[model samples]
Target: MSKKKEALLAQYAGHITEKFSETPNMAFLDKVVTGLGPAIYNRDAALVSGSDESELETVKANFLIKKLGLEDGPHLMHAIKEVIREYGASERNKYRAVVYYILARRFNKEGIYK
Candidate 1:
């Protein structure tokens, strides 16, 4: 990984450990970050807005359904809401990598990254 990417990954891992209180699987997390490509470099794109309905919908439609190949249903939205809750409603900067990591783990879709 590039120095910048590596630094960002470390920063993300720190946030995950600090906020979520869980040590992330480095390999899987790396894959998630890599999969995100250039978006990670963009400040706005790197963060998930838990308060935005459309943002959450995009995560469900694009990431969960399309990327993970999950079926559309109420459960998907429920899962997204659940994740958002776990991520903390008061949390302003919800990193997309962390959110995607949690969602991927929730759906057992980590294998897709491999």
Candidate 2:
């Protein structure tokens, strides 16, 4: 991921944590942050140490799917992209959090998560 994207995901993680603070479960927040930034950074390390495409995919997918265990990954992925839009408004992560949280809440309520 680009540095720009890495920064975006960080803010997204903070936004997610803030918005979902009332929720009992924090699994998704943890899962996504694991899927990005350090995740890419870690992959770079693995590749430098000689990991292949299949090996890399296996590692990334396992973290994104199995660890996150979200029922709908594509939606979550999209929401992350949407959260990326907030990178421009770094000081306004709270705004982005509100927006994405609503997106997530709706996705859940509409059964999109299933």
- Taken over the whole model, the C-alpha lDDT of each candidate is 0.91, 0.40
lDDT of 2 by residue, 20-114 (tens): 44442334433333433343334343121111345334433553345434564555555544433433334332332233334445345323222
TM-score of each prediction? 0.93, 0.29
lDDT of 1 by residue, 1-114 (tens): 799999999988987787778898999999999999999999999999988999999999999998999999999989988877887877888899989998898899999997
Per TM-score, the best of the predicted structures is: 1
Output the number of the lDDT-best candidate: 1
The C-alpha RMSD in Å for every predicted model, in order, reads 1.1, 11.2
Candidate 2 Cα errors over 4 Å, as ranges: 22-93, 107-114
Clashing pairs in 2: none
